[model samples]
Target: MHRQSVAARARQALQSKPRASQHRKTRGRVALSNNHRAFRHELHYITRGGGRPVILVHGIAASHSEWGHLIPDLAACGYHVYAPDLPGHGNSPKPGDAQYYQVESLLVQLETWIESLNLQEPPLLIGHSLGGYLGLAYARDHSGEVRGLVLINPLYSPRQLSPVLNLMRKRPQLGEKALRATPKWVIQALVHLDPSAATQFSPQIRQQIAADYKRASPNIVYLTQSLPDMTASLPLVKAPTLVIWGEKDLSLNPASFPELVKLLPNAAGCPIAGCGHQPHLCKHQEVNRLVLEFMNSAAVAR
Candidate 1:
């Protein structure tokens, strides 16, 4: 009876929600104008489809193009997917100040965007790499607003990835250059080296990613060069979580998986076979399957 009642409530909620197309047109205009004014150091985001709202956040030095393959798939599966290029990345305005690049700033912008869009319930927060960490932080900070969380190969700690880079970040000049010079080819080589993630996007898409990165701000790059320790931020997340790791990720030590799993109290663990850092790009079908199953279970259980 309780399950049926919850389903009935969800159905009613869906029925009462505004039409997707109308919301998209209104919200898109608002977001575009906000970006033009360089308001709040916010990022640029694209929304596609309608149904359940799903926000896609990308990892360090990455644009929403990271979710390229999965966006259309998710939309086809009846989700309203919103993917953002965090400030300093893609088309978003990147202020030179490091303070605006902090995780807290991103969270604030996310909250603002959600409110501006007039989304009543918190959307399912899906983040990749650093994005996953942000999702964790956002859920922790705004427990009442989120539906659930999905993290894909997210960074768990600052000390683990590359201590040398972490140390280098202390020197502002070198760090600035490092961030500014981080080319898409270099990033592509680092994560999508394996066969699966390598060829998923066409040359045109690759060119676009390169263009976005070329135009990204050094401040955005510098701040993301070293992953923040999101471990402290984990305890606040109360929603059901899903953590997906690529079996062959060379970026963050795959060994950290067990440690991260234990930290997420409400999380389910899944391994993407034959994939690396960007599983959503490499293993879309498998990822979609896992996500759909997880979401359906959550809805039914509610």
Candidate 2:
């Protein structure tokens, strides 16, 4: 009888070993699913890391590749980052229809992308320029869906345009034709007009920018048209917000920074000295530090 009892104990231990192994395998699969899945939407995005999630949005005429330098840094700092190439830019499909360029339509695509990912928690939304404006609109509509927001050199109004752009706006048809007909060199020249923006690009990045410009010219009209709606939605955003601007930013008016902070109920602003429109590219180290700090503080507060 003692021999039989010992045999039974050994059988039980063998069964339990497999159960323990199975549990570990299941845990690993869960982690893999979170960190390695292709998110389908109008945009093509890259996902990395495996911690609290953060969505990075690029500005007008920019793609997910624009965040190339910043993605690895954020991922290493313990955040899962999703950087999407907005429709009509990067590898994403560019539909000629004006409807897809509307702020509301872009918001819909973003909401769908987030839901499809099935994130474990609400994500931090970060945007630059045109993207910043879209992030504000998203936070306003889905207040409970976002933990926090970071807007880098956000475009608040059409009045913020440079003199060259203002002149272009006066002859919309001619401007549109010229943009669509311009050679790639002209597009590159126009894009690099801002010294701060130009200095940030490597040769590879410059090629990508040139290609994006060719495809994105048609979408520019829609971008300007959506400005009024974006401005209208600013006061409604309820998320803890951090607005970072480049002091030397020529893309958007520095004077509007104070007005932007005042428009949001729970928002703060920071200006990076000697930086321009593309802070994440031009002043990545400082931008990353501030972003991490703001996100951590906001997480703790909640």
Candidate 3:
């Protein structure tokens, strides 16, 4: 009876071992191939159609979720929307050095990603805030690869944000310490200053965004260090560009858009009603309609 019981126990252990191994293999496969996989793997993105590629780039300290409401709406409108979290902001891996977060370095990664995906003839680049700057840079670096440009309250001449941005850059260690020490509630309180920011985001999203901002603050400071000189880069962006600005944006003044439009070789400025800096989030339907209309008009002309 003792031997029989021992044998039974041994068999159960053997079975459990293989089961565990098989379970691990299954999980590994899922992790490796998940649509949202990040890092050395192609930057994770979602696609819904087989049409012209529309790439959405989020601004500083934001993730793909910034474009969450906008992505599906655009995809439903028959666009192949590609929205990925820039490095360190979302699930993507961060480099050991913050210098990698600089605009020049980020642009290199963007180009590599375009080639990695083998985008055919320049994607329709739509960027918000800092992303607008990156999109402009991408169009400049790879002129023919871009079909058109859409700027959503983008950081054009950096002069507007220099005081805060320069302070962080000049004192990275102090800024990093202060950011790390900030309480989650404090971050949320700060966000509440945006007229409709809290209403637009769910509780869970607000927490996650606060965490993201704190984690990526150092990298964001580095990225915006040279933003004041960004205006000179505008002339290189010759694509048919559309600039959208919210009339009551506290984060970015509306006056900047008119000057930005004049700087671009071919650009149109549009004002969004009752919206703040994030029209895409606060006024999604209107934003989508305008973007679709602009894209459709450009498509017809081509």
lDDT of each: 0.67, 0.70, 0.68
Model 1 lDDT tens row, 2-103: 332322332343234332322333444245223223343544788999987899998766788778778887899888998888877776676766645555
Choose the strongest candidate by lDDT: 2
* Clash pairs (backbone) in predicted model 3: 122-145
In model 2, which regions exceed 4 Å deviation? 1-41, 166-172, 197-201, 229-233, 298-302
> Over the stretch 216-290, how does candidate 3's per-residue lDDT look in tens digits?
645555666644366877887778999998877776667888889999988999998777778887778788888
Q: What is the TM-score of each candidate against the true structure?
A: 0.77, 0.78, 0.79
Backbone collisions counted per model: 0, 0, 1
Candidate 1 deviant stretches above 4 angstroms? 1-26, 29-39, 179-209, 224-228, 299-301
Give candidate 3's error at residue 261 in angstroms: 0.5
Worst window of 10 by summed lDDT in candidate 1: 1-10
lDDT of 2: 0.70
Q: Candidate 1 vs candidate 3: which has greater lDDT?
A: 3
Using lDDT as the measure, what is the rank order of every candidate, best first?
2, 3, 1
- Comparing 1 with 2 on lDDT, the higher-scoring candidate is 2
